[model samples]
Each structure stands twice: as structure tokens, then as C-alpha cells.
Target: MRDTMKPCQHTLSDDVVYKDVVVVGNGPSGMVTSFVLAGNVPYLKDIPEDLPIDEMLRARLSNLPPGQSLYDADLLELAEGLEGRSQNPISLLMDNLLRPCADLGIQADSLIEWRYDVEKEIDHVVLGRGPPGGAWHTFPPQVRTLSPGAWLSLPPHTTDSAERLTASAVAEYCRRYVQACHLQRYFRCNVVVTSVTAAPPGTGAPCSPACPRSASYCVSGYDHKEGRGFRYACRRVVIAAGACDRPNVLPEHISHHALHQLAALEKAAQLNQQHPKSQSRCWWWVRGVSAADAVRLARASGLHVYHLHRTAADSLAKLPLLNYPDYNQVYKMMCDGASGNYTNYKSLPEHMIVEVTPLLSPQTTNTEEENKIRLKKVKLLNLVTNKTVELTVYIVAVLIGSKPDLFFLQTNFDLNTIEIKKCKCNEKKIDEKQCFLRNHWHYLKSVLGQSIQSCKSRYLNYTEINGNIDTKCALPDCNKRDTCTCNTKAERGLAVRECKCEIIPYSNLRREKNCQCQPTNPYSSGLGYGIDPKKPVDGRSNPVAIDKSTHEMFNFPGMYALGPLTADNFIRFIPGGALALVTHIHREMKSE
Candidate 1:
């Protein structure tokens, strides 16, 4: 083995900076994580009646002091003891505290009390492409969040209003959050991370005197503002950069008039102001829920939209109607077709454009102006009818979805070659039967989307297909996909017994091994986290397998995946991922 201490192996950048922890992305997740690491700790304030929390969790908290400060150990213990929704306990706990029983229509006070403790502070730096709001800064000001304003708030600095917040408002709130929490000094905007690799042993000073295990990772990137390359060797690194940076692009080449996001739509609207008001129509090919916002933007800009989607109206059922009113309204417009009050919209279900060709029509003498405006004919393929149709429009916007840019991790290392070991049980295993019995509830909850309150009952929430409950089977004799139907009264008891799918533990999920750990995040793309080096990274691929208790990757020791990368896409739940990460690091430093 090469000596890691001797500076003879590989050249270290001369301007390399060292820190205890380096967080990627200064978005909501990044901001929340930085705030916790900056010494803000949450304590138990007061538990309310019927909060829908795990019974064991309630018992554990009841024993603690009225204003007891929850350290890493306390949090880890509570998370481990939690039942029913333990896939990401820290996130679940945080969501419950921040918005207590929101689904049940119970307006309860927060049970958490936050206090600043300089002793718990960790040395860290947050790096992002833009300011604190991440992708929100890039969205059009008119676009609003699906959830209410309170859902977008960072903990310890929350909002009481229930109205939906605009993109600009959310961005401003994120910037103000950093300043309010005194975390501005740790955030570095306009920096793009290029690579993150294991540092040479004894390459630089450790995070602290005792925690020598950290500061073993080397991060390299480019500083956009400074116009120079930068390097950092930190004890630990957190990937919170989020999934919206890279939009999923179609394979077919099209004209420059194509728009992927609402921001681009806004830009296109400004440039086309010279066009006649009567000739206002845009062609859109959309897939995921994100496209709903784009449709709103197009209509708001006085453009009639011709929306095309691959699937039928059933796919829209995945969105929660109560929380996502805007999405629900969009779904209603699609279902009702292009008539009545929704005359400005046109829905083309089960159809996709196969080809886009620019039409050669009459042009003006001004070359620049003529190039800016043109007509394109799109060939659409109806999947059900096997027919092709063509339509002409000024703009073609394809809004499928997006994923986090995990290219840094992939390009730096071939993850497939890494060896993985089976996770050890916390206590001595007596027998396989007993172990299964003890962990059966957790396994069931993980498969059913991790929350008893959020699980959709078969009788109440199942989509009807041809007048029958959707079994996800085409033929009459075919076996149904593991989904079971249960009445509301028997939901808990029947689901536990009938939902007998494989109970793979979170620690066993390995990207290199290509294990299919279904996405626990409700809004996830339903794509497995495994990374196939040969394939392109979509909006959901390359998610690191993390230990929920600590938010640390199983294969990589000092690395953590936070926010949407961990399946906690919603802002309300990201703070918990942050707490898990900070608490784990704080505990390690204290132990050393």
C-alpha cells in the first residue's frame, strides 16, 4: 500500500481549502442543513393530542425533559425506536413537528423549540450555481409552488400564512433565511462542482483534532464568479444540489424555439411580443407533473396551448388532490377536454411527436427577426390508434422532468466496481424468524409509501379502470402486481398480512449492485436509484443509498445525500434530512 501521509503519490492543488464539511447546492435543503450545522438545535417544546406520531416515539419523547435539548444520540434513539414510517425517520419527524397532522386537518402548534448552541457548531461551506434558493431563482416570478407557502419555509424560521407562494417570494425567503440564521458566511454562490473523490490519507489537516476520520474527501470545481478553478478537502461532503438543474431532453433534434421550463417560456414570450395577438398558440409535449406549471405560464402569457401527453388521465391520480389544488385543476382541464371554460387549452392524450421539421414559408427582409419567428410542423404518433398527425406552431415546449446532476460522482469513479458488505444487525440475531417478526411492520410501511396517514386505501383511493379497481393487470388470468385492495376499516390489519413483498433493508440498497429500491419519496419519478454507467442519468438516477438514521451513504463513509437526492423532495421534509446529517457529524466529532 502507498503511504498516504507522504506527499509523493499525487499532486495536491496549492490553493486547496480545507473544511470539516462541504455541502453542494445552497437551496432549501442546503440552507437548512447549514443552519443546523451553524449551531441551531431543536428541542421538544410540547406534544399535542392525537398528532398521528408513532406510539413508541410518543413514549420516548414523553420521558424527556419539557424543554430537553435533542442531541445526536437522542435523535438517533428516537428514530430507531420509531414505527410505521421509518424509511426516513428524521424527515418524517421533522415534517410532523413542522406541520403537525396537516393531512388530518388538525391545526396544531409545533412541538419543537430551537436554540442556538455555539458548542455544537461545525465548520462547513455551502457551494451552489446561484444564490440560496437553488433552481427557484431560475423559475419565472409568476410560477407558484404546488404546496402552500408554509410548506416552503425553513424550520426555526417558518411562515403562518396558508397561501401558495410565488417563485420570487420563495427565492427571497431562502436568501433571508441564510441571513436570519447567520449562515450567509458559509454559502458560496455561482460555484459548480466538477468532481468529488476520496482524498489521500493524511492529505491535509483533519476537521478537528479528535475527528481525524473526516476531511478525507477531496472536492474540485470551478468558481463562476472568480473565473478560476477551486479545490477543497473536507472531512465530509453532502450532495443537496437538487434534481432540477438538468432537464430531461428528447432524442429528436428540434428548432431553437423549444422551451423546457417556465423560465424559458417567459423568455420566449418576451421575444414574441411583436407577433400579432390573434396568432397566439404553442405546442407542448409534457410527461411529468412539472409540466403543469409550464402550461399555466403559456396560458397566462395569452397563448392557447396544445398539450400532448403519453399516458391517459389515470396517471394524474398520483397527485394528492387536497394539497395540490393547482395540479388538480390542471388534471380537471385535461379530463374535461378542450371545451367550456377551458377553451384556451387542448389536450392530446396518448400521443407523442415523432418528428419536428421547420416549414419554409414567406419571410421578411430582416434576417434576425425572421430567424426569431418561424413555423414548425410536428408529426405526432397516437400510441393507441397507430396513426400520425401533424400540427404547426411557433413554439414547441417539451417538459418531461429532471434529475440531479450526479455526473461528478460518476465521472470521477466507476461505482460498479466497488465492493459492498451486508449491513450488520444492531443486536445479536437469534434467528431469522424472530428478526422477520420484529421488523415486519417497518417493511410493510416502507412498501406502502412510509406513512399510515398518507397511504392510499384501495377502496377509497384506487383508480377505476373500465369500471373495475385497477389491478395493474391486462389479462383476466394474469397475476396482479403486488397491490392489494382493503377497506378503510381493515387497511391497517389487512395491509400488514396481505402486502407480502420482499423486505429489503435500506442499508442493503447499493447503486453498484443495481438493486431496485423503490423510491420512498412520494413525488419521486418511480425510477430505481441504481446507476448504470452506460445509460444517461435521468431526473431520478444515481441517488446514493443512505442510512436514514445518519443520512450517510452505505458505501462511502464520510459522504451524505440530502434533500431531493434522498427522496425528501418537498421542502417541508428536507430539514429532517439536514438534522440527521448534522447530528451524525456532531456525534462523531464529540466521540473523537
Candidate 2:
């Protein structure tokens, strides 16, 4: 409710609101419901194939017009355009948006390509992961997870809540097959949502409040000079708001991470000096480390200082995910635990309740550009009993959730209405002994070894762990305490995983000092620093806004991500509170 934040439209009204069903977000879940209903229902017939969808990435339409042919043709072209390229589009259209509406009996127009602008359109910027930074949608977090469903958020919860799975598919369907399709009917491009008022019935037009109904969708309106504002009002609103469409909002605790690492490194130094040179080999042999991975490593090592067994990718570099320290340690930990009985399901530890899937994310997913991965919930499968149970997730689905004016009958003020708090992602622990943020470059330097250098004097430094780090250390805390997130500058934040408000830290083998602080981006623009550098800046080495990781989007046979994105039996996603939603539609005849 700060002036800096935009007023969300999903707030609750004073009246006791009632409807057939009040689906909050317009993302996959809501869209599937509506795409299933749209023209099939008795009243709203001839529903245009051109349902207005938000642009997932900045893209452009070569030719814009009306009707199904153009849409389909353009979509084909777009898909073909992306044939060999591997990048995650901001929005992914689902086939459910095109599925035959069970009631109205109309075939939905599923997206098959990138329909919206890739580089031109501007999304209303907000953190879609972590939590609901003040948003509302059709389903609650619980309903989403239990159904084996998926979602995405930037900062965490945008409980103006909703679904992501189906819609993401449709976004792709349209983009790949509906390019010049007939989108002229349902909406106007660039109509960013500006305001929403869910007052009592008869509050305005028939589509307005007095009716006590909500809107289907409200996006930025359009104007020639200044862009138009948002729109509202829809009977039986089929919201498309999802939890995975928010922007990046990095944690502001680089400092805390440093200190945590410093403590961890100090212990490692003791081990390095005592251990033999052969034992001083780098941590795991994995090659690339992503921002999300670092964060994950940090979370798992909270309090208990967990060391990086090595640095490398789970696949290409020859390291196995199951064999990695974090993976093996967790697997070992899972092995020791007894098979969880169904009768005692409610008492499961928070971590075992996780379920994972391939979906977009909001964390520092910047490192593996060619390896764009999507996340779903983590499910706990009892290795002993072969029984699989759904685990709640702490997801950062905000990036995929926030959109304007869907499920607008409420304004979040009504206390009786379910209070949708902005769930935040987790952050790091600032323990005095190990300040990773203070020694980020130091630890990194240690890991990188010859490939990297160390931070200057007074700054933190990274050193090799040797065999000493792999085993135990002599630190007072190490002797007395359990674990921690070592040199990896990963920490907890506003949203732990899915939007649960809890700031905690992960254990990365809590270290003492050192890192890769040798200036990755120290070049001064248009000046002396550019004299010696010869690398092209168009981004051979520079950071590209869009990640170009492998074609890990659709799970096509030779194209699935080597790891992370794959949900094949071995994965698990966990969270706090999640549920499954069941919907049934009934048609109302106008003649009545």
C-alpha cells in the first residue's frame, strides 16, 4: 500500500459477492476455463479466435490483420522462425486456450507461435516470482500445486493468484501458428491497465459494479501519442493472470552473502593448509553455475554450512547431478529417513514436500542462457514404499502472475475475504562467523583457481577447499553447530520459494573468504577502458537481455534440458500451502 506501488485491482469489496465461480488470474487456469467457454456458451457466440494475450517476450508482428487464416499462417511462420533457436518467450500460449469448450462445444484457438511483439511491446513491469506482491487471481496457491499444476513468479506471490502451465503452452501455440491471426476482435495492443473499481452492484455500466461482477481482463489501453491505459469489466470473467510473468527484483543483501562466505572460507583455509595438494582439487567438476542454482544451494545449507563439492554442470562437463555434493547429500539424507506413512502425511518435513517441474523462473536465471529451464512443484516420493505424495512449493511465480484487472470484484480491503498477502522469496542468513557476501569474489577465486583471480586487499578472497573442506573443520561454530551456505553467495529473501514470506539462508559449506571480484563489467563506456578490450560488445561475452540457452522449452526429444527442467520421476517441488481446484460450468439461456 505504499505510494510507489500500483493499486492492485483484485481487492475485495464490502458486499457479500457471489458468482458461479470467481477465477482470479487470467493465466492458464482461468484461460483454460474461458477458452473452454468463450463462444460455446449460449450468449457469447462467434467468439473471435483472436483472444487478447500478453506478450511473453518483446516481439513484433510482421503483418497485422483479421480472421483465422492470417493468424494461423503468422503463427506457423513464427514457430518456424524459432525452429533452431532456443530461448524462452515471455508468454507461452496453451492449447487449452484452444481446447473445445465442453459446454458451448466450440474448438478453442490454441496458439502455435510467437503472436505478440518480441522487442517492441513493453510489459507492465513487476516482480512475478517469490510472492504475491499484492495481486489476485482465480486459484489459491494450494489449489494450484495439488492438481499437479504449475506456475511462475518473479519475486514470489502475486496472489492476485493464478495458473501458468496451460497458458504458457498456448502462448507458444499462438506464437508458432497464429501470427497474422484475427486478434482484432478481442483487444487493442498496448492498452496497459491503469485502474479498477470493484464497487457494489449498479456502480456504473451494466458491465460495471451494480452488477457486482468482475472483469475478464484489463490491459493497457491504446492511444496514438501517449499509450492508452488499462480496461475492465467482464461477465464470468476468464482471467489470464498467471504467477510467472513478473520482472527481476534481486535481493539487496550482497553484503550479507559476503560475510556468510567469509566465515565459511576461514574454515576452508584451515582445511586447505592441512590437506595434501591432491586433495585440493576444485569442488564438483560441474562447469556452469546459474543464479537460481546458487540460491538453491544457499537455501539447502542454512545454519548447516554445506560446501560446494565442486563447480560444473550436471551434464556436458561430465559431472552427474545425483553424484554432486548437494544432490548426493540430499539423496543420502532422504535415504536415511523412513518411508513416510500416508496416515502421517501432514507431519512431513518442509523440504521433503517439494515438487519440481520445467518452467520459467524469476531468480538469477541469467547464467545458463542456452539452458532456459522452467520449474514446477517438488513432490516427495517415498523411495522405500514407492508411494508418491504432492509437496507444497515455495515458488517465485510472480513474474508469471501479475497482470491488470482480472477478478476485479474485490479490492483486497474486505477482511472476510481470503486475505492474499504478498508472499516473499527467502533471503540469506547474516551470521557473524560466515559472511559470504563479504567474501564472494574470494571463494569464487578459490573455486575458479587458475581460470580466475582474487579480490584486492581488505576485500574478501576465495580459496580452494582441498580435502579439508570436504570433511570437517576446527571452527568453534563448526565444532558446535551443524551446517551453512559456504562461498556461494546464495541467501534467502522476500519469497522463500513460491511466495511464502520467510527470509532464511541456504548452506553452501559456510566459508571464510575470497572470490571472483576482478571486475566482470569494469569497462568504462566511451573512454580509456575500451582501448585494450577487443571482444565485441553486441554480446558474444556481454550479457544478452534474453537468454539463448538450449531449446529446453517444449521437451522435444533431443532438446530437453540436460537437467533441472526435466520432471522425469527424479524431481521434487516443495512449498508451504497449496491446493487443487475443481471447476464445473453451467450454461444459462438468454430466453429465460
Indicate which candidate wins on TM-score.
Answer: 1
- Evaluate all candidate structures by whole-model CA lDDT and list the values in order: 0.63, 0.24
* Model 1 weakest 10-residue run by lDDT: 511-520
For residues 202-303, what per-residue lDDT tens digits would candidate 1 score against the true structure?
A: 745544343433357777777897988687888789988787865656652643446667677677776666567534656465755667777776677677
- In candidate 1, how many Å is residue 76 off? 4.9
TM-score of model 1 vs. true structure: 0.72
List clashing residue pairs in candidate 1: 214-235, 215-234, 215-235, 402-539, 403-539
**Number of clashes recorded per candidate:** 5, 267
Model 2, C-alpha of 326: deviation from truth (Å): 12
Candidate 1 error regions (>4 Å): 1-14, 48-54, 65-68, 72-77, 80-87, 201-214, 254-257, 277-281, 312-326, 338-342, 360-373, 410-542
lDDT of 2 by residue, 363-394 (tens): 57443321221223334445446667652222
